[model samples]
Target chain A: MLILIVEDEKELALSIRDYLKGIQDITCDLAPNFSKAVELTELYSYDCLIVDLGLPDGDGLEIIKKVKTEDAQTGIIIISARDTLDDRLKGLNIGADDYLTKPFHLSELQARIASVLRRIRFDGKSILKEGVLEVDTVQRKIKVNGKEPDLTKSEFNILEYLITNKNKVVTKASIAEHILGEYSDMYSSYDFVYTHIKNLRKKLVELGCPDYIKTVYGTGYIFETA
Target chain B: MNLLTKTSLLITTVALTVLMAGGVIFFLSTKEMINKQVDKELISEMHFVMRSFDNLVHGRDTVFYEELTIIPTDEIISPVARFRDTIRLNVFDNKYHTYRALFFGFRKGGNNYKIEIFKSLIDSNTLIERVTLVWIGMSLFLIVAIYFLNKLIFKSTWKDFFEILKLAKSYDLKKPHKKVLLKESEINEFASLNTVITQLLERVERDFNNQKELTANTSHELQTPLSIIRMKAELLLQTPDLTSEQVRLISDILATTDRLSRLNKSLLTISKIENNQFRETEKISLHEKIRSLAGQFKELIDEKGLKISMTLEETTIEIHPLLADLLLVNLLGNAILHNPVENGRILLELKNNILKIANTGDHIELDKENIFHRYFRQSKNPGSTGIGLSIVKKICEYYDIDLDYRYRNNLHTFILDLSSLYTS
Candidate 1:
């Protein structure tokens, strides 16, 4: 999938590009200004656009509007430093697919992008299959060898987030956020994460599945299908 | 007293004092002049009676002698005349009338004879009394007239002042309001007062806007660098050949960056809240909000082996939904975070529109004064951002909820008086 990243900050843009470069299907094009973004969008069609609201030349909302007017099918994500509800609502109202505030985890961003892409491309029904595991995104069900395992809502969310960023280290903080939403910071200890992951591993292992989830000591857990 | 009443009272008092003094002086002076006129008339009557006696003796003039008297004395008195006041019965009116009398000795027909001439002072005394009565009446009228007139003038003159007071009383810094215009005043003092007030309000507004912009810019400027650092650290952790020490260091970097980001976000939230951006409100049930929050934190609570007992009533509050959520989250989060690790107790009670969250924690009391201040950390826990309670306090203040903390029986209790929500 060809995507465009429009951000004025050079280092942040490069980091996002480098991070997404690890994904097999994502090809990112960077634009440092609003004019360049508009120029690129006019020159070539893209699968998605990551637009920053505060650009040096003009507003990123203009690009979102232009793209939306031209092709309503193209997904657009707004990454803004403004975390106000008004801005979030406005961006969503302007046909943007998702909104992420600045200082977001790159893995979280990747997961959101994947979700947005899945939504726009598949029209809701999407499934994932690994060696012995299958995930029905629409049904929120996980299967191993055609047998489903009982998973709680939080565990299911965590599994989806891990699987979406499969083969990459996902922090405990990100998983906590995924499960608990914005109030995840209220947890003084991440021992709950440890327990959920342990239960998940046990359930999967009991289903005759190999241990695909690896612990990166001092960092987080990574789901590896490699 | 208010300015108008006090000024009127002062004017009345001064007028009463001056008028009373003038009335007394006027009465005394008019009486003195009347007495002097009576004395002059008495002396003239004495002269006229003496001339009449001489004329009668010399056969020259005839004058009325009703007010005159003649008395014979054995010895000749001094030729000088003596005048005095006396009261005598009069045959004409059958009433005792005060008289101004003069007695003199003169030789007539070779014998010493004394002439006594007196005039009645009844008219003069009556005139003096009448003049005094009039003076008293006029003085009272003038005093009352000046008092009421001064009151009327003061009320009209202070209209601009009262308007300024109303403007100041109605001005609220947090709420958006109409432009405050000071009406033009004919009084120089009130005009200058309006000018000063306007300048002061402008300065306060300017400072407020500057602080708001600073907060916005600071947060905006900080987020990008923080994200870059976090991304770099995450990328470094992804390196295949990195040792355990390197990964740990990168994780540490990421953790600090995350903490900084959270801190910045909290400050921004505080600034936004103070700027009154979240003015929209809705009805929210505390029982449901608490139950949901507890359910979300159930895993953490269970993992810590803590017991949470909730005794929530059917309490509802009118507040901004987002603030309501944050207030409960922060309070509940603080309770859970500070509770003892094993066998800790948390009691959540909402009775009489007051929420009390008591938890088993440290044996000591936290600083009550500075507890709600930003960055006041009560513990050395690495995960405690020290801003959660501050956010709770800010939300409580926004809603006019009274918050108090007490430490008793090894339980740190945070009492939130949510009764204000209902009253408003």
Candidate 2:
């Protein structure tokens, strides 16, 4: 998959570029300004674009609008520091597939990018599989080696969020945000996140799946298959 | 009373006093003048009779009253005249009428004789009554006319005052220029008032915008650096191999960065709210809101083994929905954040128009001095930005809701009186 990251901040753009390039199967390009973003979107036929809503030259929503008309199949994800609902709606309304707030885990951004790509190319499949653990999101079912695991709804959600952003550190707040809302980043408490994560790990271990969920000691949870 | 009414009262009091006093003085003086005329005529007749005393002595005796009898007195060293007021029977209607009479004593044909002369005073009485009636009618008309005149005159004269008032009331702080809203009054007092008010509003608006600018610039400028630090710490976590202590230290760094990011966002949110930037409002259910947040925090509640009771009735309020959600999150999130880890109790009740939230927490009172201040934390957690309650207070202030705090027996209660915001 080819992706374009349109962010003005040099360090943030470079970090995101490096992270995406290191994904092994994906190629990423960086644009530091709105004109460059427009120029790149016009010249290339990328599978997806990651945008920041606030850019020095122009708004990132304008780029989403420009690309959406040219190639409707290309997925777009908006990452912004202005996390208000109004800003989120505007990005979505302008044909962006997903939105992420800033100071977010790059892992969360990666998960959102993956989901957008899957929706475009994978026949919009709701099922996610990490090794022998498989989840049918539409049916809310979890299966392990042709057998189902007795996971509660809350436990299932936590597992799904963790596995989607696999191999990257996802904050407990991010997990809580998935369960709660965008405001959960501010309102998160450690105790509740630990309870959910603990139950999810216990359920997975009982089902004979590899212990994929790792705690980042005071940071958050990470799901990996190494 | 309003200015017009007050002025009319003072003017009317002075006017009535002067008119009433003038009427009394005129009535008395007019009566004296009439009496003088009557006395002069009586004295002239006495003079005519005295000059023609021989006539009264011989032929003019019939000019006296029908029952008059001349009396001789030894005490008449000189001729004397006196007047007295009396009631005399009206011959035509037999109603007693007021009469003022003059008596003159003189020596006639060597005998001291006295003659009493009276003119019926019915006309005088009628004249006095007519004068009094006119005076009373004029007093009422004069007072009433003065009130109405003041009402009409001041209303137009003070149009500029009302305009200034409206300008002051409707000035929007977010709008850059407001000098055009108020006009210079032609009246000196109001013009001075206009100048002073304009200067004051300009000063206040400048101060307010400076504060907003400082908050916005601080938050926005800090975001990129904070983002860089946070992303760098997050990137360092993906290191190939690190000791346990290194991982723990990096994790703490990440957590601190994350907390700092949230603090920046909170300051920005507060600045926007204080600027009244969120003018959009919608009707939303309070009960559903609290229920949804409770569901979100259920895990946290269970983790602490806290007992939370929520009794929500069906009620809705017209508010900026985002603000409403923030209010719920901060208040309830604080409840969860501050609850004791063991046997913590939280009760949320929506009774009447008040949202009463009580929780079991520190036995001693939280710092009451800076409880609602930003960054003045009450919890042991050093990461507390203390912006949560301040945000709650700001939202409450925006909606004009009354927020009260009470602590009793180790239970702190927050009551929000959104009484008037209820629509159903």
Candidate 3:
């Protein structure tokens, strides 16, 4: 997948590109200004565009509009420091696929990108199979060796999250956010995340699958199929 | 008293006093003029009588008086007269009326002849009385007319003033409104009042906005660098064969960066809320909203071994749905975080437009006043962002919703009364 990150902040944009490359097999480009971003979008076909609402040259929401006017199918994600509901809604209304506030976990951005790509390219059914583990996106079910396991809604969500982003280090915060929605802000500790992941791993291993969850010592957990 | 009432009272008193004084002066002046006229008439009549008497004595004038007295004593060589006011009998009307009489002593033909002549002063007296009465009546009329005219003119003249006063009274500094100036009147004072007040309000709003901008920008500008620091620490933690002390330091750095991110986000949230940035609202079912939010806490609640109950009815309310959700989440999280060590009980109820969330716990010993302030942490963990309740309080204030915290019987309850919430 080819992606363009339209952000002026050099370090943040570089980190985001490096993080994405480390986690997934994808090529990324950076545009430092509105004109350059527009020029790049014209010069090459992109699978997705990461647009920042605060650009030094111009308002990036207008860029979303301009880009969508030319190519309506380019998946756009808005990464902004403006977190108001109005700003989020405006971006979404203007053909942006998702919205993420700044100072966010790169893993959260990765999950959003994957979701947006699946939505735009696959047109709905997003299934994943790694070794003997499989997730049916349409049925919201998980199967091991063609046998389904009894998983609750949150358990299912967590499994799908880890399996899709296999081999990528996902933070505990990102996992909580992915499963709990906005209620993730209420977490005072990650003990709940540890318990949920332990239960999910037990359920999977009991159904005759190898242990695939790896903890990165001081950091969060990583789902490894390699 | 109010300005209008006080002015009317003062004006009436002054006008009445002046009218009374003028009436008294007018009556006295008119009485003196009438007396002088009466004295002049009496003198003229005495002269005429003396002339007629002289004529009769010389045998050249016919005189009606047939009786005369002569005295040869020498009291005066010329005529000496005295005048006295007396009431005499009127032969025509048979009613005694006031009269001015002139008595003169003189020597005629070497003998002193005394003549007493009296004329009626009834007509002059009646004229003086009538003139005094008319003056009093006119003075009273002028006083009443002036009072009414002053009242009517005052009300019409201050119409613009009252309008500007009303606008000032209703103006709120917190929620600024546009078009603060009234329609400019032709009067200079009223127009000046409108201009100054509008300019003052605009200045206040601009200054408030600038301060809010500073807060928002400062918080927003900190996010990128904090993210960089946090991500770098995260990347460093990824390297292999690091010592325990090294891991500890890098993780500490990561933890501090995370805390900073949360702090900055909270500050941004507060500024946005106060700036009236979140304006989207919808009709949301309290039951469904509560259920969905509570379900999100299922894992934590279960892991903590806490019990929560809900007695909710599906009442729909109009509010910013996101804020309503946030309010519920914060309150419930507070309940769980503050619950006792074991067997904690939480009871939630929504009845009669009041949302009551009661939890079983020891009294938190919160300062009733500063509990809602930013960075007020009661727990010893020192990890609490300490801004959750403050944000909830702000949201409640925005909606004019009444929020109260109380502890009794070791049960801390947060009550939100939604019935009295007003939109306008």
Candidate 4:
């Protein structure tokens, strides 16, 4: 999938581009200014566009509007330094798929990007599979080797987030934010993430599944598949 | 009393006092002058009668008239006239009337004679009464006229002042350049007041805009670099062959960056709230809000083995929804953050427009004065950002809610008095 990143901060844009490039199927194009963004959006079609509202030349919202008008199918996510509810509501009101504030976890961003893509492409019916493990994204059900394991809502969300950013280190903070909300960080406690992961790992291991989830001590959890 | 009413009352009192005193003095003086004139008339008439009697001394005896009476006496005395006021029955009107009389004894035709002449004071009394009635009527008219005239003058003079008050009451910093329809007044004070108020509003609006620009610039400038640093640290963690020490260092960097980002967001939220940017408000069921937040923090609560007891009544408040969420989250976060690690207790009670959250924590009381200040951390826990309570304070201030803290019965209690924002 080809994605467009429009950000005035060149280093931040490059980091996002490089981070999203970790996935084998994803390609990212960069636009450092509004005019360049508008030019690029007009030149090529993209599956999704990541936009920043504050640009040097013009408003990044205009690019989202233009891209949306040209192709309603293209997914749009606004990544802004402005975390105000007003801007978030305005971005969503303008038909953007999701809004993420700046200084976000790259893992969280990638999870959101994957979620948005899954929602648009398969209309929430997509199933992710790795060996004997299968997750039905639409029905929120998990299966391992033709058997089902009871998973709580939060565990399911955490599992999906980990699987989406599979092979990458997903911080406990990132998982909490993905499961709860952006403001959950202020709670400053990730013990719940540990508990849910513990239960999920026990359930999976009891169901004859290998231990695919690994803890990168003091950093975060990683979903390692061998 | 207001300025107009006070002035009118003072003027009326002084005018009535002066008018009453002047009326009484004028009536008395006029009565004395009229009595003196009557005495003079009576004395002149007595002289005329004596002169006429002298001319006809051998031809006429002593004459008797109602106004002039002459009587014969045996004793002879010097002739001297004296005046006396008398009340006599008038035959024509058949009523008692006041009279000024002059009496003298003289010797005529070798016989002693006395003569009395009287002048009635009826006309002078009538004149004084008419003058006094007219004075009273004129004074009444003058007082009434002055009162209304004073009111009219004050109303017109204060028109510009009232307009200025209205403009100030409706002043909004968001729309700083809104038209000011000020009515000019001839009074120097009011005109100068208008100029000063306009200048003040302009200055405030300029300051507000500057503050807003600073917040935005800070968000962009600071958050972008923080974002870069975090992303760099995150990328560094993904290196192909990293040692445990390197990972630990990277983790520290990420953690510190997260703290910095949270601090920046809190400061920005405070500035935004102070700027009155979150003007949208709606009625929120606080009972439901507390329950939802309690559910969200259930994991954190259970992990600490803390006992959370809730006593909530159906209460609603009008506030910005985001702020409402932030307020509850921060308060709940504090309760969980400051509680003891194991077997701690947290109690949430919402009753009668007051919300109380008590938790088992530090044995000593937190400083009441500085608890709500930014960066007031009671614990050495690195995870505590120390700005959560400040954010809560800012949100409460924005909605004009009263927040108080106390340590009693071995629990730290945060009491939020939400009566001002209570909609139900």
Candidate 5:
């Protein structure tokens, strides 16, 4: 899946790209400011969009609005250092699917991406099937070839979201907001999302499901059927 | 009550009293002196008349008697009966008297003679009387003039005082231009007071703004590194064929980053609360809000296997919704985190604008006074940042909500009095 990150902070943006790259087969486009983000939004089609509230030319909310207007189908997530509940609510109210406070773990981000994809693709469906592996979104259940498989909720959601998105790249911010919810914007914290994702991945491997979630370095995740 | 009015009243009252007393005393003393002088002159004139009688009877010397009559009697008796120009005379004698004295060619006699003398006094007394009247009138006028002058001075200064008060009422730390324009007072006391107030207000505004800016800048600065750490950890986790120890190490890094982020957020929240920066106000249902928060934290509560019971009253209150949400989140989060396993239980009750949350926990010895202080942690709980209750306390103070904490029988209870919320 293709994901676009619009942030002015070069180091942080590059790091986010690299983190998502480690997740799965995903392509990333980076925009440093509002003008660049607008240019990219107008030029390319992305499965998901990650935006920062503070931009050099304009506010990130405006960009999110523009992107939504351009591509109503594209999922938007706001990644900002503004961790206030009001900021989060405002972003969400403006049609951004989720909000990630700054300083989020990449694994958590991946998990969030998986969850958003699951919600967007499956709506409220309980079971998500991709080839031989099937994930139960609601009961946190997993199965491989119709056999019961052990998987934590985090793992199941991640696998389910990726499988739903299939070949689409999901950004780190999308994953973070989905798993951590409003608290994902906290820059120095990643424990909740990271620990859950680690446990989920471990359980998924133990359950003998083929590891389809691939990482693209410096970008995000992609679920490919081999 | 004001300074000028008070002073003017005091001066006018004292001056009127003194002037009236002095005027009465002068009038009485002048009258006594005139009466004494008149008696002395009359007695002298009687002697002169007796001396002239021998001349008149024996030698027929009328000029001597006439000269005695011309001797000034005005010093002894007033010549005017009214406040205008007029002159008149009269003489009386005892029935046994053989001769009498008269003026203007008239003779009257029989026993001893008695005479009354008067002359037009308008010309002589007019200037003195007018001068005295004018002096008294001027004194009264001076009293009123001084009183009003003082009032005028005080009114201007008092206006400045009111202006200062008004400026203080609307003082905004965020906007320094909103500060009052202080005028220099002619009164030393008022000027000094104004100076002190202005200085204090300026210092408070500066300190508050500095603290706010510091929190915002620090939070922003901290974000970049945290993001970098999180991203690096994700990159490491994505490495193919990572050993267990490596995975654990990466996971540990991620956890540390998460903790740091939480800490940063909490610190920022505390600063915001302290500065009273979050001013958004809304009407919210207290019971419904608490229930929603409880639902959100259900995963944590269930993980601890704690049974929760609630008794909520249907009431709506106006407050900053974020503050209310934070208050509940911290309290519930703390209860869940500190609850004893297995048979742990949490009971929440809301009624009469009061909210109570009680949870079963290990016995704790704490200094109640210090519990709400920032960075104060109880001896047994090392996981707490010590700012949760502090934040709650700040919210309560800002909203005028009352909060109390108590522990009894292995149950920790937090009571919040929300009466102010209802009133507001």
Candidate 6:
């Protein structure tokens, strides 16, 4: 899967690219500004697009609309540091799949992206099942030996994404962008992703689900069926 | 009701009263003196008649009567006769014998003889009537003269006064070079008044222009740096491989940008209030406004672990909402911001057209008089912009609202007298 991040912050874009590398078989591209972001959008097709609101040349919302218009099938999420309720409502009203305020956890972002993908591509159905380990995406219900186990929305989404993309590495940036949406701009420090991943892992282990989501140190996450 | 009309009316009333009173007194007293003179001459003629009759009767001389008749009686009685047509006389003998005497009187020598003489007072009355008529005519003429003189004084002086007044009313600061044209009056007071007014107008125009320019320049200067800071933050976010420290720095920049924006807005608000740019009327509920402000600041209050209590009486007050809001915001925000953390408590009470907000805080360091001065923040408080209380004071002054601040037992209380809301 390919993901494109068009942001004016070069450091933030690179960090996002680095985080995506941890996800197996996933590639990422970066665009540093409005003009460059526009160029990248025209030249590439991606599974998801992360767009920031403030751009060097123009407004980020304009770019998001243009990109969405160009590729209606692409899943777009807005990331903005502007936490005003009006800004959030406006971004959502303009067909953004999710709006994220700044200073958010990366794992939360990853869960959101997975959820969006499942909803759009897989019709929110988990196709990966092994014996007693069955993940239900539509209901966010997990079944171990035909006994349903309770899961939070974040936990269920995290488990489902890891299982669907088994034997692959998912970077912290991808996860952060997915859950935190545009808010990752505020958390450019990249430390919040560790806590959310840690929590998700601890929950999955306690539930007796397969422990496949792994932290690739200094990079991202990897889910293995071993 | 205008000054000129009022003053001139008063002058006319007083002048007319004095002139008419003097005219009446002069007419009455002059008539009395003329009557007294007529009475005195009549008495002297009566005496002369008695003496002449006595001589004639005693000497038994018929020549005395003839001599008296040749004495030109017109001279002796003309003054009285001029006022009367005829003079009548009566003579009484010792046995009460009576004779009708004309012009003069005669009497017997040994036998007691009494003589009485009277000139016709009808002519005297006629003369007195003529004199009164002339006196009244002269008085009328004098009153007319005095009235015209008063009118002349009022006309010249009032014209100049009105001209100065018109110039003052039409004075425009935008056209400072246009001099108020006043015809120079000989009256020193009016001339001096004109000079003073012209000087005052010039000074006012100068000060107004200077203030406008200062505000314009200050606003421009502040806005420029604010814009630059915002743009710089946006640009900084675009840098590659930014460390965690760099990210933190950018966040700081953004926060400062927000503060600067707020400052700019507050300054603009103060300027607007100072210039009286807002309309003077609005209907607002003081209770509802305080409730709304409390709700808005609820989070900050909660975060500081402060307990807030409110007791508001139901009342609908009318005032300018902008000024009222500004006043409330500053007072409440100040109370919240200055209070000690965890120990902070606010008591908001509104009743009897008074709003009192009290909060726990450090003791006020400065004298109360300096509290409302611009940029006069209390010592040892770093977070305050100092302009908040000043803005509150200005709003109170403009709306004629009374604001009082007091500190007691580590509690700072601000009282807003909303009495003007009802009266205005």
Q: A-chain TM-score per prediction?
A: 0.96, 0.87, 0.93, 0.95, 0.66, 0.69
* Higher-ranked by DockQ: 1 or 4: 1
lDDT of 6 at A89: 81
> Runs in model 4 with CA error above 4 Å?
A123-125, B1-212
Error of 3 at B63 (Å): 20
Give a tens-digit lDDT track for model 3, residues B70-121.
2334555346767677777777888888876666776566666555567677
Q: Each prediction's DockQ?
A: 0.63, 0.37, 0.40, 0.51, 0.24, 0.05
Q: Give a tens-digit lDDT track for model 2, residues B39-143.
A: 787677666766866655564443545223244566664467777887777668878877777677777666766666677777877888898899889888988
lDDT of each: 0.85, 0.80, 0.79, 0.85, 0.68, 0.64
Highest lDDT among the candidates is held by which one? 4
Off by over 4 Å in 2: A123-127, A185-188, B1-184, B365-370
From the highest TM-score down, the ranking of the candidates is 1, 3, 2, 4, 5, 6
Q: Cα lDDT for residue A45, model 2?
A: 96
What value of lDDT does candidate 1 attain over all alpha carbons? Answer: 0.85
lDDT tens digits by residue: candidate 4, B32-114: 89988898888788778788876634455666665776777777655898888898878789899988888889776578887
* lDDT at B37, model 2: 81
Where does the lowest 10-residue lDDT sum fall in candidate 4 chain B? B172-181
- Candidate 5 residues lying further than 4 Å off, grouped into runs, are A89-95, A114-131, A136-226, B1-188, B241-248, B380-382
Model 5 reproduces a share of the real contacts of 0.41
* Rank list by lDDT: 4, 1, 2, 3, 5, 6
Candidate 2: lDDT of A36? 97
lDDT of 6 by residue, A46-159 (tens): 778888887778888887788778777777778765544568889877777887644333334455666666665765254447555777767667777666656656556556
Top candidate on DockQ is: 1
